[model samples]
Target: MARITAGVGSSHVPLLGVAADTGKDADSYFGPIFEGYEWTRAWEREEKPDVVILVYNDHASAFDMKIIPTFAIGCGERYMPADEGWGPRAVPPVLGHPDLAWHIAQSLILDEFDMTIINEMEVDHGLTVPLTMMFGKPEAWPAKVIPLAVNVVTYPPPSGNRCWALGEAIARAVASFPEDLNVQIWGTGGMSHQLQSPRAGLINREWDNRFIDSLIGEGQEARQISHIEYLRETGTEGIEMVMWLVMRGALGARTRALHRHYHVPCSNTAIGHLVLLPDNGEQPGTDDDRALATT
Candidate 1:
C-alpha cells in the first residue's frame, strides 16, 4: 500500500530571495520567530521523499483574477517561471509528471471532486521561492513536484473547508495509483502575515501560533474554522493559511512533527516551516513517485 512518508510546509516570501541576493543574513530579520525551516531541513534528509505534491497559492502569476479555479492541477510537461517586476529568473523550467497528474485528475473527477486541469502554465514566485528554500536551487529540486495551485488573490476564494476537501481528494488520488510509489505532499505558505492592501506587513503572532497548533493537533478539524473569521482576525492575505490545511489533511490522523520554525519581517513577509513524518514507518519516497508520463 502507498503511504505518505513525509510532508513539508513553508512560506514563499519573495523578499527572502531579494534579501539573500543582496547579501544579507536574511535569517536575522526573522531569526527570533521562524524556528520551522531548520527542523524541516533535517526532516527532508531523513525522509528523502521522491515526489512532493506542492500546494501553494498563485499571486496573479499563472491564473489571473479574471478566471480562478479553486483547485488547479498542473498537467503540463513544463512550467515556465513567471516574470515578477524583475525579469523571470533564469532557473530551470518545471517539468511535470503528466501521466500521474492525469491519473490524479481522473481519479478526483471520478470521486466527484472537480478541478481545473492545466496543461501549459507558468508558476510564479509563490511556487519557486519555497522550492529554492527547500531544494537549494530552482535547477536542483530534490524531488519531482506536482504543482497544486490554489487561488488566494481573488475575493471570496475557496473556503478553508473546501481546501481541506481537496486534500482528502488528493490523498485518495494518490492512494489509488496502480503503480507502487511513496510520495510526500507539501503545503506551502501562511503563518499570520498580510502582503496586500493597507494591512500589508501585518504579523499576528497569536493567530500564527493558533494556526500552527491546530494544524498539528486538530488536523482536518482545523478546516472547520471559517474564512471570514480568518480574514477578520488574521488579516485578508493571511487567508493563505487555508493552503496549509491541504498538507495536514494529506497526513495521517497522527503524525510525528519532526521540526518547525517561524520568523517575521523576512522582507515584508512572515517566514515559517514545518515537517511531518508518517507514523507507519515507510521509506520517505520511491522511484515511482518521480515517474513521468508514459506515452
Candidate 2:
C-alpha cells in the first residue's frame, strides 16, 4: 500500500522564486536564503518520494473573490504555472498524479471534508515556490505533485484544528491505496508575516521559533494554537502557519526532525523549513546529520 514516508513544512515567499529564477539566489543578499535549503535539496535527492501532496494556498491565482473553497484538491493531469501580473516564471509545468489525486479527493469527500475537486487550475507562487526551494532548477521536477490548496487568503479560513483533522484523513486515505508508492506530504506558507499596512512587515521571531519548537516536539501544542493568537501575535498573514499542522498531523503520533532551517526577513517573511520522518525507533545519524555536518 502507498504510505506517507515524510512531511515537510516550508514558507512560500514569492520573492524567493524570483531570486531563484533571475539567478540572484547566489548573491550575498539572497544567497543565505537559498543556502538554507542546500541540505534539504541534497537530502531530497537521496530520499525522493514517488508523489508529493503539496498543501498551499491560492493567492487569487486560480480562484478569486467570486469563488473560494475552504479546501481544494487538484485532480488534473498537469498544472501550469500562473502568470501573477508579471508573466509566469520560467518553470516547467507541475505534473499531477491523477489516480492518486482522485483517490484522495474521493476519500476526503467521503470522510466529510467537503473538498472542492478541481480538474484544472493554474498554480501560483504559493504552490511553485516551495517546489523550487526544494528541487532547484531541474528540467523537470523529480516527483509528481498533487496540489492541495487551502483558503488562507480569505476571511474565516479553516481553523488549525480542522486542518490537522484533514491531514489525519489524508493519512487514512493514503494508507488505503494499494499501489506500492512512497508519498510525502508538504505543508507550505508562513513563519509569521503580514503584507498589508498598519502592521505591515510584521514578523514575530520568538513566536515563530516557539511554534516551530512545539511543532517539532510534541505537536499537540502547535495544533491547539488559536486563530486569534496567530493574528494578534504573528500578524494577519501569519495565520498561514495553521496549514503546517496539516502536515504534522499526517505524520502520525511521533516523528524525528530530520532537517530544520529558519531564516528571518526573507522579503519581510520568516522562511521556515522542516523535514520530518515518522519515528520508528530509527537513529538520528541519517542523511540529514551528514548534510548538517558538512554545512
Candidate 3:
C-alpha cells in the first residue's frame, strides 16, 4: 500500500523546452511560466514518494494516430524519451512498477475499463517537459514513473467522466496490492489554448478556471462529463482536461492544493500547474524501494 503524496500535471508544449534550453524565453516565455515547477524541486527533496503514476496523452508518437487506447499503462522496466528535434534531453529513462501496473491492468479489465499495456514506448514532451520542469533536468531522472497514457487526439476519445472512473479504479487496484509503497499520481496537459487550425493561439482563461474548479471540487460528476461537450465547448485541444479528472479522482476527495499556476502563449497552449497533497485520512504503506527507469 503506497501512500500517494502528491499529484502533478502540466502541458507538454515543445516550444517551452526549446526556449528553456536555448535560453530564448528568459523573460516573457519561460521565466514566469516555469515558476509553478520550482516547487517540484522542493517536493522531490522533501516529499519524495516511491513511485509516480503519470497520466499524459501521447500526440502522434509511439502509438501514433493510428490506434490509440483510452488509457495505456507502461509495464516495462524503462521507457525511451522521444526526440523532439532538439534531441533527447539526456535524462534517465523512466522506471515502471510492473507489479502495480499489472495489477491495475488486471483490475481495470475485470472492472470493465479499456486500457493498453506497453512493454516499450518512447515518451515525447507530453510527459518529459513537465517532468523536467518540476524535477529539474539532471543527467537522469530521480524517481520511477509509470505512464498511464490517454488518447485525446483522434475522435471517439473517452469522456471526462470515464477518465475519472478510471482513476477510482486505479486507486482501488493500488490499495488492494499486497505491497506497501508511497506513490504519486500525475495528470498533464491543457488549460484551454488550442494549438492547431486557423484559430490557433486561442486562450480561454474563464473556461480554464472553471475546469480547474470543477476538477478539484466535483468528484464523480466531474469525471463523468461527456467528451462531446469538452470538444464542442472547450475546443478540440481543450479536451485534454479529461486527464486531470483522472488525477483528481485518484486523490483524496478533500485534498488541499499546495500550489497552482496557469500561463498561456507557449506555442498555442495554456500551461497549467497544480500540486495536490492527499490528507491524513489514508494510512502509510510499509514498502522499501526507490524507482527509476530508462526506455
Question: TM-scores, in order shown?
Answer: 0.86, 0.96, 0.88
For residues 10-122, what per-residue lDDT tens digits would candidate 1 score against the true structure? 78877655544454533566434323444455446666666678899887777775788988889877788888879786567777778778988998889887789989878
Per-residue lDDT of candidate 2, residues 1-295 (tens digit): 9999999999999999999999999998889888989988987898878999999999999999999999999999999999999999999999999999999999999999999999999999999999999999999999999999999999988988899899999999999999989999999999898889899999898998888777665458777788899999999999999888899989887877777888877888888888887776656666545322222
Q: Flag regions of model 2 displaced more than 4 Å.
A: 282-295
By TM-score, the better pick of 2 and 3 is 2
lDDT of 3 by residue, 39-86 (tens): 666766677667788898887778865777778988888888887666
Best by TM-score: 2
Candidate 2, 269: how far from true, in Å? 1.4
lDDT, model 2, position 160: 89
* Candidate 1 segments whose C-alpha is farther than 4 A from its true place: 21-27, 30-36, 196-198, 280-295
User: Where does candidate 1 clash, by residue pair?
Assistant: 33-262, 34-262, 34-263, 35-260, 35-261, 35-262, 36-260, 36-261
TM-score: model 3 vs. ground truth: 0.88
lDDT of 1: 0.72
The candidate with the higher TM-score, 1 or 3, is 3
What's the C-alpha lDDT at position 234 in model 2? 93
